[model samples]
Target: MATKEPSFEEQLAQLQQIVNQLEQGNTPLEEALEQFQTGIKLAKSLQNKLTSAEKTLGHLIDDAGNERVYENNTDDPSNNGGGNRGFGSGDSVKG
Candidate 1:
């Protein structure tokens, strides 16, 4: 049987643990270097996963199986020219 892959949260926790260990300043030079390298790889992987998730969330899928980019309607004139729409405002997409 193949080994199971670690989830994103698990990887993140591992990276945090590595950081804590390095911060303690007790590990030997060679071991510390190895841990640092591993931490870097984990950071990059986490970043890539976050970026991919963001891209996925930035789009909307219609019932017609068409994909559309999610856009903020901050330019709507009904707001009386006030563009102070807070976060998550203008989430509705007009057809």
Candidate 2:
């Protein structure tokens, strides 16, 4: 099945609409419960998509158009906190 490609705003709006409809309190108990389940699924799917997208796109950039990629050197014996990880005030930046 093809998942809908909805922007964050659009998904949020749909979620709100579902909430509003459920909140009106006029639907039958069975229908209300079904709507609630659908809303929960929508919320979970939206959350997961947003989180994955964030992780995929998360990054730091410099004024010189350099991408900052940080690698932990904890396993290296030379890295003993003797410096500030060579990152500060854009002087010693990442990447």
Candidate 3:
């Protein structure tokens, strides 16, 4: 389910849960650092999600008084021992 699309609210809630645990849980230095790194990742993810939403909403306004929408079709390769990331179209996999 890692690749499944998550809503903005869901992502924010999950990130808060992670932060709260890190603040309350007692752990060794190494584990704490690892959690900190994870927190950074979650922060980036939340930022990206919010940015995308903002962009989508602003797509209705343009310099020429026209409205347009942008679609992200980032190519993602399938997980068949290939060299692609496999997150979008133009990719195939073999079982």
Candidate 4:
């Protein structure tokens, strides 16, 4: 039998626990180093998951039921070409 992989939430919680342990300043140097490395790996895995989700959400279905890449309407008067100012630019999602 194979071991089941932890879900994203479980991995995030484990990373938080590791951070708390490191912050308490009670663990020995070697243990602390090990936890720190594990935390880095978990963080990277979480980031990759988020990026993949964002890409998936970049697709949309129109009224005609045609699948198309989502496009931010920067030309709208209210948008003022700053629709994606804070988040990543719309061009980041390529079809």
Candidate 5:
């Protein structure tokens, strides 16, 4: 059976342990190399997760509790709702 992939926290914890072990300099060269590779993979996975989260969090919401994606143009006149608009801003900002 295939092994389950670790969650983000688990992966981060494993990566930390790997770093600690490698830093101790007690592992044999070959074993240390393998740990290093594993750590790199974990790091990449964590990074990708973080990137995905940032994109998700960056999504702007409209006044009616609807999600509105931010476009490349920050100065778009259509989006000028001041600080009261988007995300968790109060209902007063609703257009």
Candidate 6:
């Protein structure tokens, strides 16, 4: 049987574990490369999920009566939508 895709949280947890393993620097070069590739894929998936959520939610309201629209500035270098931030980035989901 085919394995089910992991949930976002599970994927993020796995990505975090991969990051920790990669950071250890003890893995063989070949294995490290594979892990790095997996990290890249996971990062992309997480980013896409966030982008979708932003589109679905429309906008957000801050605690101080501030309304903010979800805008994705892909051109912004500071936008950690990709590998910019360490693995495991997304909005929290409660089951």
lDDT of 1 by residue, 1-95 (tens): 99997899999999999999999999999999999999999999998898677667767999999999775434364653335566557577669
- What does candidate 4's lDDT look like per residue over 5-84, in tens digits? 89999999999999999999999999999999999999999988976775567678899999887755343545443456
Off by over 4 Å in 5: 1-3, 63-66, 69-95
Instruction: Give me the overall lDDT of model 6.
Output: 0.79
For model 3, which pairs clash?
76-86, 76-87, 76-88, 77-86
The runs of at least 3 residues in candidate 3 whose Cα sits more than 4 Å from the true structure, single-residue gaps closed, are 61-95
- The numbered model that scores best in lDDT is 1
Whole-model Cα lDDT of every candidate shown, in order: 0.83, 0.72, 0.67, 0.82, 0.81, 0.79
In candidate 5, what are the lDDT values of residues 1-95, reduced to their tens digit?
99998899999999999999999999999999999999999999999997677567657988899987663334344554233467665645646
Candidate 6 residue-wise lDDT, 1-67, digit = tens: 9999888899899999999999999999999999999999999999889768755575688999887
Native-referenced Cα lDDT, model 1: 0.83
lDDT of 4 at 41: 99
Taking every candidate in turn, the Cα RMSD to the unseen true structure, in Å, is 9.2, 10.7, 12.7, 9.3, 9.7, 13.0
Worst 10 residues of 3 by lDDT: 73-82
lDDT of 5 at 64: 98
Better of 3 and 6 by lDDT: 6
lDDT of 3 by residue, 1-95 (tens): 47876776777777787678778877777887877787788788888876676566645657898877544333332342233444664676668
CA error at residue 65 for candidate 3, angstroms: 11
Please report the candidate that would top TM-score against the real structure: 1
TM-score of 2: 0.53
Relative to the unseen true structure, what is the C-alpha lDDT of residue 17 in candidate 2, on a scale of 0 to 100? 90
Q: How would you order the candidates by TM-score, starting with the best?
A: 1, 4, 5, 6, 2, 3
